[model samples]
Target: MKNINSKKLLPINMNSIIEGHMVIIKPISKKEINKTYLSWLNDSQINKYLEVRHNKQTINGIFDYVNSHRSRENSEVFAIFTKKGIHIGNIGVIYDKDNKYVEYGIMIGNKKAQMLGLGGEATILMFEFLFKNKGFRKIFNGVISKNESSWKLFESIGSTREGILRGQCICSSKKPCDVYLYGILRKEWLNSRKKYLNILKNIKIKNG
Candidate 1:
């Protein structure tokens, strides 16, 4: 992705902290990719709902793909890691130059990481970075009709349903799957932060 403006990347001291336990979403670094991540990508359980599930993927192929896109101005990918440093998944934002909007995509490569609120945490952090740091005006996302959890996550964060693209995705069975569009504008997101924080609070209470 385009290097974040140098001024935007300046180190700043923080007095307040968001209290919670979840995956850490940070820019993808060379050190984060390894055999473990490769294996996670190949796992059928993790790739079940993903569009790129094909025959066994090679490590070299994965490396080449990630490395090739590292410098692109339209996208930014982050490796999701737990507090203990275990790699759990990845999340990314793709800016559509013509549309002037960014679309988000995320995958929990580790099955065990699913439904732990980690995805929501990573998504919130990414949204903040995109809006405050990257100066994005709006964000968009598409979720497979069958992926209820993903849809809920987006909805819980105040993304409005923009309609569905029927039979837009082709799965392994060669069957068409519907995709639901969700979007949130910068002002909408800022206004809804308290609502999202409440959702997080409820999740913590339930888990406790």
Candidate 2:
């Protein structure tokens, strides 16, 4: 994997508490992707809700996608690991120049890590980095309506429902699905720090 310039890597406020847990968000590394990671891509349970097709993710394909995105301007992808060094998932933010908006996405591939608020913690950290360090004005995300867990995760972190895109996404099932758009502004995020901090606190307690 390509190395991210520490200078260019935005710094987030490590002190923000989410669910009473102190989660750390850091840059991804090649070590995070191994044979086990490839197996994750092949896992039907994990790929069911993702946009990418599992059959398309060859070893080279994974490396190329990660390296290319890492080198892109206004885009960042971080491997979500706990301070204890457990790999939970990955999260990314993409800034659209044409719309002047940033969009974010994440996945918790580890079944053991699901529903534990780790995704929310990682997202909060990334959102702070985008708004404070990158000077992004707004951030948005689209979650399939069927993915209630993901929708709840976004809302728990202060994003508001923007609108619904009917028949917007076609999953591997080949059926059209409604995509729910959610977004948060810099001002809205600033106001949500307290709630996020509380969530972080809880996460720390649970992890401990």
Candidate 3:
């Protein structure tokens, strides 16, 4: 089997914030890792499709996890904040330098913030930043098969359903769940930027 070296020694330089009309993503800080953040990981419903749900989470564990990524060069974690400056969730990326690609994961920790399309806005912002600013060739995302909304959101951003990793995740259901791999090339996203921007504009206007 060919080894996939996902980590790189180069820093992501996540100092600048990526902003959308509805949300802004900035590097996560130690101050943000509080009890509420801890609860997001431990909540069964919140983490139903997340691997972190497999283990019980504590404040210390959450801190350690956040710190580990903070100190890593290839990994970046960002706190998702609304235009009102409320921190609602977190998104992260790990650079697969060898493959010239990036893998991302996201979670909307605040229940009140869920279903408002904030996650979608954050995702578009992330894609634009990584593709236009970072010079990455591609971006990848994976979703549990049962998470229809998540996968559909990714598709709306022009990511293709690349493949399925059979029984890759043991979900909260205690049953093995297939993982849906979604990927988008930088050029493809760039080409569709106008269409997506229009959609985003409509969403903003509608929401406001």
Candidate with the greatest TM-score versus the true structure: 3
TM-score between model 3 and native = 0.86
Query: What TM-score, computed on C-alpha atoms, does each candidate reach?
Result: 0.79, 0.79, 0.86
Better of 2 and 3 by TM-score: 3
Model 3 per-residue lDDT at 167: 96
**Candidate 2 at residue 103, lDDT?**
77
Residues 147-189, candidate 3: write the lDDT tens digits.
Answer: 9999999998799999999999888878999999999999999
Tens digits of lDDT, candidate 2, 8-70: 333221222222253555555667667666677778788777766536566665665565565
Instruction: For model 1, give the 10-residue run with minimal summed lDDT.
Output: 7-16
- Looking at candidate 2, the ten consecutive residues that score lowest on lDDT are 11-20
Which scores better on lDDT, 2 or 3? Answer: 3
**Which regions in candidate 1 have their CA more than 4 angstroms from the true location?**
1-21, 198-208
* Model 1 pairs whose backbones collide: none
Kindly list the per-residue Cα lDDT of model 1 for residues 79-195, writing each as its tens digit.
778878787888766777777788889988877888888888878776766675567889999898888899998998889999999999876566888999999999888887776
C-alpha local distance difference test of each model: 0.69, 0.69, 0.79
Prediction RMSDs, each to the true structure: 6.9, 5.8, 6.2
